[model samples]
Target: MTATTTAANPDAPATAPRYEISVGGMTCAACAARVERRLNKLDGVSASVNYATERAQVSCGPDVDPRLLVEQVQRAGYQARRVDDVAGADGDDDSEQARRVTDLRRRLAVAAVLAVPLCDLSLALSLFPELRFPGWQWVCLVLAAPVVGWCALPFHRVALAGARHGRSSMDTLVSGGVLASSAWSLWVMVAGGTPAPGLGQGLSVVNGGGHALYLEVAAGVTTFVLAGRYFEARAKRSAGAAMRALLTLGAKDVEVVRADGTRRVPVTELLVGDVFLARPGEKIATDAVVVEGRSALDVSTLTGEPVPREVGVGDQAVGGAVNVGGWLRLRATRVGADTQLARMARLVRDAQQGKAAAQRLADRVAAVFVPAVLALAALTAAGWLLAGQPAGLALTATVAVLVVACPCALGLATPTAVLVGTGRGASLGVFIKGPAALEATRAVDTVVLDKTGTLTEGRMRLVDVRPASGQASAELLAMAGAVEAASEHPIAAAITAEAGAVPAVTEFEALPGLGARGLVDGRAVVVGREPLLAELGMAVPDELRAGRGELERAGATVVLVGWDGHARGLLAVADTVRTTSAAAVAALRGLGLHPMLVTGDNAGTAAAVAAEVGIDDVVAETLPADKVDVVRRLQRDGHRVAVVGDGVNDAAALAAADLGMAIGAGTDAAIEAADIVLAREDLLVVPDAVELARRTHRTIRGNLWWAFGYNVAALPLAMTGLLSPLVAGAAMSLSSVFVVSHSLRLRAFRPNR
Candidate 1:
């Protein structure tokens, strides 16, 4: 048995462990792109930054220092620290995140409260003409002051930080818009006198000099932008909630047993090889093997299967499983980073760091977008001022340009869709590795499915039974089943299941990996494969071999049952094909995706299973490593391929495929390598994921076009002075709202077929 070991990765760094950094102060997708670019520029370092998660996963070489990562992030005007250290070092964890949300809510409330009265007063004075008061400008000024300066503090702070780092973001555009609009409004209030106001003037007050007072514009923009951020923060938090829940599932404390006495210790203090007592309804402290008792363990938290796994002495039990049966004593075999739960968390982190092709383009464009918009706004103002336009008119156009061109939509176009899509996938039992997983799935023209544990239940069972003509099948099975019952091998258990009750057998003997030899009811009986039959001196009749040739060709593990040294019957054992495998294959084909079987099993076995599952393409008798080569060959043929498997041996192939989908019930290594993990072990989810990906990919593109189209049409209108700052501000807010709303459509997704 090639027992899977996961702690020591063949691809691990020699001296430095990978660090997942909790990045602070990223305001947009462009900010994440910049941080990733800066970190990657360092020698012997690679980084993937996700703005939605506010996390950076970094890999460093022995030649480089890990501290350099923190320093580089700091220089880029963001904070970074190891994920495990971030929450405790600053005395902030979930509370810090909650506090940020609270801050946005409070600021939004303040801006809303102050802006409402200011707008109401301005409207009343403009329409009635008799509501004028002494220094009403001062009252308007006082109300607009904190709404712009204090309520919009987050924008100004991030904008200034970006400026310090020689960059700009959506925040810069927003801050500039508010400042330009507010500054000009103050100028008119102090230098120009307000004549009587009238109706149908919108939010602007036109005085004797034709100068405009935009107190409402200043307050409204701040309120709208603040509302967008508050909702955006809430959505981002929702996308990451699953990972946080997974991290918290570990048992906080464990009961340790020793020669001195039984005592409880924190789970972190438990060591490898320690003996621990797990009573009924308690979670296993760490990965261990039951040594003294039997119980059924519920492994659903990790595998997503509700079935409880029965364990006896020497059966390995994984961490995070709840003991559902009687008390059991287990010896810890793996702990801390070695546990399966930690590995899944690490894989989730790594997957979140990757950027999809569309996302990369979006981020790169956003990096250049902010600066270009600033220049355009300046040029819009300069062109007006140079053309003999009044300063008030020029500034109005400039502020309008800035407000209209804010890339809130651009920054949100990809990540919002990705966040929503991935969250929906998790609920449907499909965990996507990252945005790229969906992109890859959209292009999957061929699906390479592993035989064992993927299309079949990776366990041997009785598949075919034949006896000599006129011989009683029950009588033949009775003698063979009795002799095999004394053995505990997979093939024996399968045969015994189909075999009816039989009298007791004596003189039982076992042959490892071959067959069995014994006496059943005082009659000599034997059961084994072809080689074993020959070894047992049993003469296989030519008629029997010829008649059974088709069964062997169809992938059954043919075994000869003999008595008195002559073949009497044949029994075939095989890994049973899943009931839904055929339907999944048909669905994939209907979707225009070619389904192929790739397996390490013998050609006969592979072909038989393929035929049963409605698959025509078959690659058989390949070694584990050769599986990767097969996937690469398919890719070289210009095929976008997805490999589905559920074992350690399939890990390499799964990773090498364009999209690697692991059955959630698979080994940890396989799950870690897969780009998509199916929590329910149902092959049908493969097609569901494919459909979901295609849908999400379409949604992202449509959103990008909407965002790009809105800015393209709005910027020119604002620059030409046809659009007011108030109108531009409303359009900008709506653009972001539209992107988020479109992305949310994915949340309602379900398996269509």
Candidate 2:
């Protein structure tokens, strides 16, 4: 879970490095906040600590050593280590969590095995004085000793560690509750004279003096709290399973195409610019551009798109894609951690390791929660004594308050949900950047979708070509294709592709957004939009003019083909709408977002695509700057807009909107600007992204409500002397388990078909 970034400067004082470190010994949100506070106290340091993942993201200058960062965390009463350093030293140390779980399981099993019989025997003897054997209290003491000493030792150790640092946590409460009950029970056993038959007579007294033995409560509370910790640890591990699975999807080894021959090498040893061979049914070693052969590659694991994408020479292939059709030679563009798969894993981890606004508030409340609970317990006990309540009743109320108000649920709520929700989104080809992106989805009421590359395929194709009266179709097409071949626009690609083979051109010049001009076979050929041709002193013939109007009206882009100051033909190009686009638009509307088409295309083309996709609002002929205006206007009109696009031109608008979702296949600029990334080509992920964020946000809110509400409702009952310590311990442990289990529900979240 280490994300490392460094900026070096020769003239500057020090370099800045940002990375993640695993934190140990955090039992609640207060501990996390404590670690965060310590790390941030350093000069030029910024930090965010997440208790759910038990990791801290820290950014500081080189002058602030990582060792110092770890020291500060240690001083805060926790263990800390740089995650990258651990990974480098141990090479995938996955056994830490397993070891922790195993230890917890062993402790819980011992506690349960002993505490059950101890509680049963004590209760049976107390309820029926006749059932008490001669040595019944001695047997209860022996059974309770191991549980209170060995099974609950972890809580005692953590509480002691916190005490040494002048801090406390949920473990403090648990340890206090257990030790108090056991101490009271031992005092009764030792101070009270040896009794033969009536030993269990007054053990069940509620309002009497504090002579009642609480061996059952001591053993029972220890067992229940240990059980909760064990289960909570396992569930938290499961919440991050999807990310772990994703991080392991890369190829382990690759066949390097060296000068001598092909040689298999570990993927870690593979370098950028090395040519590699991918055979049928083999995973592409890393992000590479195809150098030879053609194949159909399956990228479902990366992008969640089921269809196999056909790739040929010059096409880029991502790491982890399976080459399912034929052999291909690829040259690595990015290797190791620089590959797409690595970046995705890092992004998911960073998102999970971040604390949301709501979680920060919870952390603030929990920072003082343990101490406040300790104070409240004291107040309850004193008030009960002052109100003339019996010492036994006051003791019961004090223990209950300490046991019930743990704040574990408050710590687990947000991070667990975020972990599971983001993991679920990743599986469906939607990458939520962080907590901010999830929050952005809650109030989004308008969706501004770009026409080209978003709703439509964005690949232009030649649909019609009408030659002038004296020109042959072949001659006209060749001239246009030769000049267009020198250009790289989509329309040029379409004309060149349809022309098949054409004469070489010289003195080629491309007119940005208008078209291109070149000397094809030394005849001065020009191919461009009508406005460009008219500006070049070319006149459109009557027949070709009529053809251009007919094609333009039908939503096809018409570019005039002319040479030697005379128009020769009219070529029409159009982009096909993606088959899934209409359904995606409908899905967005179903989620209560108004869909609007914003494009740089002409009005007719924009309107045609909108009508086909069931969108009524259209903003056409807008430049990149104008697209931002469109989003801003909608926002000013009381709408929170989410912009979707996949081009460098759309970057500004994507950043200007309330939320931005970029297609994964788009330019780096667009992806950087967007809050979420849709990896699949299918537009349906747009709605899936929005719906998933909304669902995740709802889940977070629901978890927080339950956690806060449980404390609010449960605390009063305990303080008022209504709940016993055993029941309070059970409820406290169950609260953390419930929050974790509720978060695990997001693992089963399914995308719409």
Candidate 3:
């Protein structure tokens, strides 16, 4: 016997451990439950199957043989691989299998067409007596059989296979009940029994015992189960569409330039070191570096920023970005699965595979639920038989228990809510990584914000210019602009913009980190930071320092300009605050979370931005590596933290935090690392995501309670022979309807904030 273990429950002992197993070869819902049942049969195994992606995760005891478990799955005609190293590769086989499963939609459509008429026939016989034709009824039943069987053969096949192995599932319960009902009805018809009066019959046959054929009941149950399955496939397809769309973003081909000549080739065929020529208005086909020429690339597809970024030789260009102007020759640096887009797509795929904590609990309850119901039904029949009840009454009570105690409602609860919530979040420009991330967002207590690009507009602009030594402001600006024009730094743009007009300079020289120098109007001019001016033997006055302090307090980067090697004036430039930052910060605080600011900018600028956004705690002048350290420190202090950032530098911190949120308008590195990606740069979506996750969590819990309550309360009533088969069928259908309708409420969610 193989050892198995259940997932650690929240109320379980603290010493209990949790485990995850990777499942494979699941092609549909039936396959999901099939693997789930086989693994669950082990003493302590508890598992959930995510059909959208073919993976089953199970948790169990420490003594279980991981190898034996894998062999059990393989014996059941599917692969089972342990997730020993969570490489996050989105393994090649899963993607291919996911694509194959998408075709199940065709199967669902066929099932739906067969179900409609079967339901109509069933309803007509029950509601109107005049419509019954004694001879024609058997003909209708025969006709409906093929349609129902053909449409429902998938479930029958899986259920029969499970039964052969002494295992049972939701399919086994449903398939067994419907088959028994259909066979009994056929036997009565063939044996020449008295006909059941149609609806509105004058005779009351209730008190007197009479045999009646119920072909419609058998056909209807099969049709209804098929209908449910069709919709389930459709829902899985809809949710998995995002991963497919992400895969479609890359271009199919690129214009490759080889020694022989330039020719177009498939992107997959392009190898590293292959040079590609991208002309104005052409899309970059793969991740590459500019080897020649210059161009302004519109990376809006990846970053969501509108401004076209200028790139020259040696700059890295990402795939899917459009080259807006100027021709460029790029050497392919990364291709195929190695591209950034591919990596991001892989991340999204992996996230979908890992079930949330709530979902895992639901699976645990469902695992033993069907078998327990089956045992109760058997006991009910034996009890009534021993009490000398008629065989008809005893058998009817047993079948009713089997039919009504189904766990369909329990199975649909969490996945349905998750589907609706994730769809709603995506529409609102919130890209949730997976169900676990969606659930975790509700518990976030600290929101760590990156000062640059997140709280502020990432683009720097000139705010003020002050002249020194009694010189005219414009004169200082003109000299500064002439020298600064030779530099490519962001601060240089502000200086040149303020300098309205200046003569063309000669003898231009750049001082790397310090600044630039050039001869303007036959006079040498220098523009840079204060330290650079002092290094050039220029005097630093107290007035200049005072102006620098004021600007720095306002989150501005101060630059100094000089003429003839003498200090001239100071210029202040800073990235402005976003209009939505304050409202977003306030909303987070309303949710009982303290917002903190973390940035690579200096202390003065970080403090200014934090104050503006109502963030109380600030960590400034922090390097990329230090950001992750800070998040760990906060976590060590027992904070459930979520980090929000928008730069490549923030990737480490984003991956380190409890929940990582990447502002959509940033580098691919940040988006790939973070668990949640805000599709719109608006900060309000952060709080909106949290609220949505919380609502989803509530719906799941409510649905779980409803599902559990129904099975617990109604199963006994059914076993006691108080419920008839007709009543049991109606109750079972209603439970499913209630679960679905409850899950649908998440679609209308609108955050109060």
**Residue 629 error, candidate 3, Å:** 8.5
Best by TM-score: 2
Better lDDT candidate (2, 3): 2
Query: Per-residue alpha-carbon lDDT of model 2 for 313-384, expressed as tens digits?
Result: 878899999999999999999987777787777667767876778988898888888889999989988988
Query: In model 2, what is the error at residue 38, expressed in angstroms?
Result: 1.2
Instruction: Output the lDDT of residue 428, model 2.
Output: 82
Error of 2 at 720 (Å): 1.2
Native-to-model Cα distance after best TM-score fit, residue 541 in candidate 2, in Å = 9.4
Instruction: Judging by lDDT against the true structure, name the best candidate.
Output: 2
Local error of candidate 1 at 21, Å? 2.9
Kindly list the per-residue Cα lDDT of model 3 for residues 1-753, writing each as its tens digit: 111222323343334334445665443334556676777677655555664455555565666676766777877866676654323323453354455445445544654455456556655765666886767556657655764476557667767777666766666766666676566656666777565421112112122123444444455555555555545445544554445545566787888988899999888799999999898888888989999999998765554445687889877788878899999999998887778666555445445555667666666666677788788878987987898875445655666777677577766776666666665665565667777677777678999998767888666778888887688987878888887777655567667766767789899987643667889999887787676788888876788889988888877977788767678888888888889899999999998888999876667988888888898899876767788899999999988899998877788999999899997657677887888887656688788878877887788788788977888888888787666555665677677667767777776788678
CA lDDT, every model vs. true structure: 0.76, 0.83, 0.69
Clashes of 1: 0
TM-score for each candidate, following the candidate numbering: 0.79, 0.88, 0.68
